[model samples]
Target: MSTPPRLTFVNRQGERHARKLSLFGLRALIEEMQCQGVTARAVLSGTGVLSKDFDDDASLITRDQRLAIYRNAQRLAKRSDVALLAGARQRISDFGIYGYALASSRTLGDALDLSFRHLRQAGPVLQITSRVEDGVIKLRSHDPESLGDLLPFVAEFWRSSNLTFLSRVLERPFPSLRMLLPYPAPPHWRAYGRTFNCPIEFEAEAMEWHFAESIWQLPLPNANPAAAKVCQRFCEQVLSEQPQGSELTDSIRAALVNRPGRFARIDDIAAHLGMSLRTLNRRLASEGLSYQSIIDDVRKTLAVEYLERTTLSVEHICERVGFSDPSNFRKAFKKWTGRSPSDFRDADLR
Candidate 1:
């Protein structure tokens, strides 16, 4: 089968994040329902994922599709707490080596640190930050990149799953967790009491979980600092398998494609992503690339595509590629391909 083109989702927050889930993650979501004896039809309806998709590790599903499947599971389970239950249902092993590294850490703090560094491997859009202040340990989950519509569902899923993971890490029912949820309380808000035995506050500006600093020293049952280090290295290797700057450059390309005639400001894209231009530049430096280089690459690639496949005028092509001057476009086109745009298009016509 032919592969579909990948897509980028820029949320209302003006932050660009992925709207897709790895097939492995989607498969587990589906299996969570099937294991509960729910029929496949209801779970799969509106999910846009086929049976074969679950078995294909390389395939992906959009955020809408994932949420629909979860909602369907909620309906099938006849409860408003589907996200709560399902999130907790996930085991550490579900994350593969990422979970293994957590289990091997010497302390909960180490495991949490590991999570902060590589959590994106499991959920790219979710950002988990950990800190200690005023004798309270705080862990915050934020998704500035998620659309407003999914704020509640996504936050609930991450929090519940995190609570489950923490309980396992500490090898006990985790200490009382004080919570602040970003959205309004739901009809099933009471489920929070039953599922999370803690003080809860809803409609807050952020999702914050506070715990006594004493929880930091709790030893993991499988604590082996040396093994944890080895595992951490492997976990990082897994994450680094992606070509660095891939996402950054791809986002630049997407912004350009979406706004054809206008050049996107690197500063604006960086700011919307809650990143400073310096940090972005440092990250791209590690990839041996820069923002303007990526923009130029995308423009040149698109220019070639337009020239070879279409009969658009050179002037129009120049405008479409964001060049205000036809002469500038001619200079760039020649510099990129060793020929003028017209010559390149005419050569292809032969």
Candidate 2:
């Protein structure tokens, strides 16, 4: 994997330096408060974003702009527990294409993988690293202290949103066994206790949480790996198609997504795009991606959708995804989702 860009600040003459969040993050919080009768201008007053940008799907705003919105939300809330309130109400659907991936994960583990894999979908300044050891599933966030005193609200809003999303996906309240944070308890932090329903370790090494092994194993009713992969590709395409994205990448993705169950080879795609195979390979390599990776991603996606959403046998699904052999497809599916096709289809979500 490529190294993530560093968060560097070189202040010459005290010029401001702040993080940048996607319009997705800004709209998520603002829309929640708007539903509660808060106006966009009221929340984004000093953010320098016009009334027009609030509804623009392609807008990007600075971290200071987001902090201003949060501060206004706190002011309008008039409560110390504003984070919990906002977190409780912030639906994962607020994330657009990303939410579809989370909703269709086969297990909490799958969902976490998708979230961590595309952490930038929430914002550029966020990272959530997760791992499993000794029956404990842990998540450590690099987004802990980016906002100074606004960290508390940011922390709660982030944590509660994840917890709520996890619970909703599993169709059960799956609270953490323990949560770790470096911040001290504020005056009205009871909302934290009420929201998490577990031990909240203050002043810890990092912002982390522990999920019981049982919780991670819980099956999700909407566990369609194929659909989740499609959503993942769509999210990546949208990002790569952004100002920072290459038009070449977007065209490649468009060609791939427009055809389901037809995993096109790089040669075919390149020809379709009216370019030499070597040129197609070079362009995608410039973006640090391989045509094979793209094809495999689509194959994994199609396989899972077939397994979960169709009565077609595994062999049929394998052929549909372009696998010539049943055995080969089974191994690939297991590698993609960490579950065999039979086990995935037979497992009961309840």
Candidate 3:
């Protein structure tokens, strides 16, 4: 495989600005606080997270309060335990904010482009970026810190974010995807298995999702074509709310991949990622995949692309894709593309 591009994270103009004073995993934060000895009952009572109108499930703590909670947690714990809360959900959603803004889009790609443009709002702790190489778009994270203990939480968050966005916006099952992580296996593998309906990898440098680039033009749910204007307006507003950026996801992806050797067991990956095996498993389950599946899917996607685009022989391709036996590669290829390697290549050449 070609050396992956060093996806450098750069800043973008703050297109739209608004406030995102707190959102996402508020309940979890509250629950975590209980363990920390700050047991206020609701967002309004114990913390400034909730207002009288904050009873709705959709409401979250304000961005300032969110940061405050993290700061408070750090103070209480006498360490920097609340780093995750440094960024706002509005910014994180900036990655997908365009989708919500669009009344309806033509393809997932169009929506994703918006996501790519705005992912910085989530914070600089983790940044998600993608590059289209050899007909496959590889999405990797940029994180400076190792998220070993937080792998499960991070994995589940990605899975949940992907599922909720795709299901709501596209109104269809996401075509099979590939996930890669550097952490090892977790206990709740089966749960992840069902959600993504694809492979997961622990201890991987990047988590890649493979789909036809053409899918970018697919139409969104709402039939109205005029929605673009509204979507664009909201995009600006979302950016305005959160002027800062994040790269935590990016760091996490990098930490997972830049490991010492080839794929390690989930336990090993988790340890490397600084997360417990169970947490990794449980988080992946929430996303409907496991660490192993992510690795398999990435290999699977690359294998086909290599076969289609290169003159390499079957054995060469197999080796490049980490397959030990030609026969096993053939079997797996058949399952993936429904044709023998020779036939598949010939068809492509034709």
Candidate 4:
């Protein structure tokens, strides 16, 4: 199988702050909350999202705002299976044109490849990856440590919703081999067995779903090459038009990179951007970011680029990225991407 293309956005931070996500996922969460007797207003409170936004197909939300809605769902929903139920309720139509592109693909593998390449268009909350190993296809989700207490809920929604989409595309039940989750089993763990119809391993090191290689070759029921091409073109057009990041954030990142080892303080960055410290803080807070977060994001982006595009040694890369201690850099890199520098490079080379 071919690897999906890397995102055009420079880094994770750019992608998250980009205002390109549709309200489909948030709408699903709101509907699920409504089913549980929670009002839409209650679920959207403090999210800076409005109910009328759902009616507009072109309305977009930032990933930060989407997370805010998820946080609210976690707080207001009565049942532990809110994510699962919400995800299960999703149909292909809920995805709009993105769904049509996948459905029109000639084979399941083609659809999976397209989905990964255009994943951001769907407004995903997690970084998903796929690989074929030992005659089995492994689909995994990378947890953003920022999710914090909402990890379990988000993980469940991602897993369940994906299974639902795959099943619908194939016009049959998904033959999942097993599931491995990082978090402990929920109180409604039995629902997982009923939903996936497979073994569930909780408290594992990662979130992954396993399937036999044959599934990849299965022909999609609604394959239409002409339609697939048109829908895919539309997806590409939308992705190309997204704003990479806010002007202020981009300026902050450039300032951080230009300084190299001597990282600028918040006050320095504020002055460089022609704003007071208070204004800088407030602006970043408005975008769900902080000075420290931007610094961390720039460091991670530079480190990953070096690892993937250069032959620099770990120690040398660490020094170049402003880390004085190689050991400390290793820990921070793993925390940022869930992989050591060497391991990340090896995977990239593969």
lDDT of 3 by residue, 256-291 (tens): 334312446778767755789898788777767766
lDDT (10s digit) by residue, model 1, range 143-258: 32233445566666666776777777777777866898877899999888877789999887666788877666767998888878887888777666632336565555555555
Order candidates by lDDT, high to low.
4, 1, 2, 3
Candidate 3, residue 140: how far the Cα is off, in Å: 0.7
Q: Between candidates 1 and 3, name the one with more favorable lDDT.
A: 1
Tell me the spans in candidate 2 whose CA falls farther than 4 Å from its real position: 1-20, 25-28, 31-38, 50-58, 124-127, 143-146, 242-350
- Runs of candidate 1 with Cα error greater than 4 angstroms are 1-32, 35-37, 40-42, 45-65, 71-77, 143-146, 225-230, 243-350
Which candidate achieves the best TM-score against the true structure?
A: 4
Off by over 4 Å in 4: 1-11, 244-350
RMSD (Cα, Å) for all candidates, in order, is 11.8, 20.2, 20.2, 13.5
Tens-digit lDDT track of model 4 for 1-350: 54333221122543555676777655677889999999999988997889998877567888778877887898888998899889888788778788889999999989988887667766676545556778777766643333556777877777778788889999999899989988778899999898888999998977778988777788998999999999999888876786666757766765665444568889987887789999999999999998888888888876875675467799988987789999999999999999999999999899
Best candidate, lDDT-wise? 4
Give all TM-scores, in the order shown: 0.59, 0.58, 0.48, 0.68
Better of 2 and 3 by lDDT: 2
* Model 4, TM vs. native: 0.68
Q: Which ten residues in a row have the lowest lDDT in candidate 3?
A: 83-92
Task: Go through the candidates in order and give each one's C-alpha lDDT.
Answer: 0.66, 0.65, 0.51, 0.78
By summed lDDT, which 10 consecutive residues of candidate 1 come out lowest?
1-10
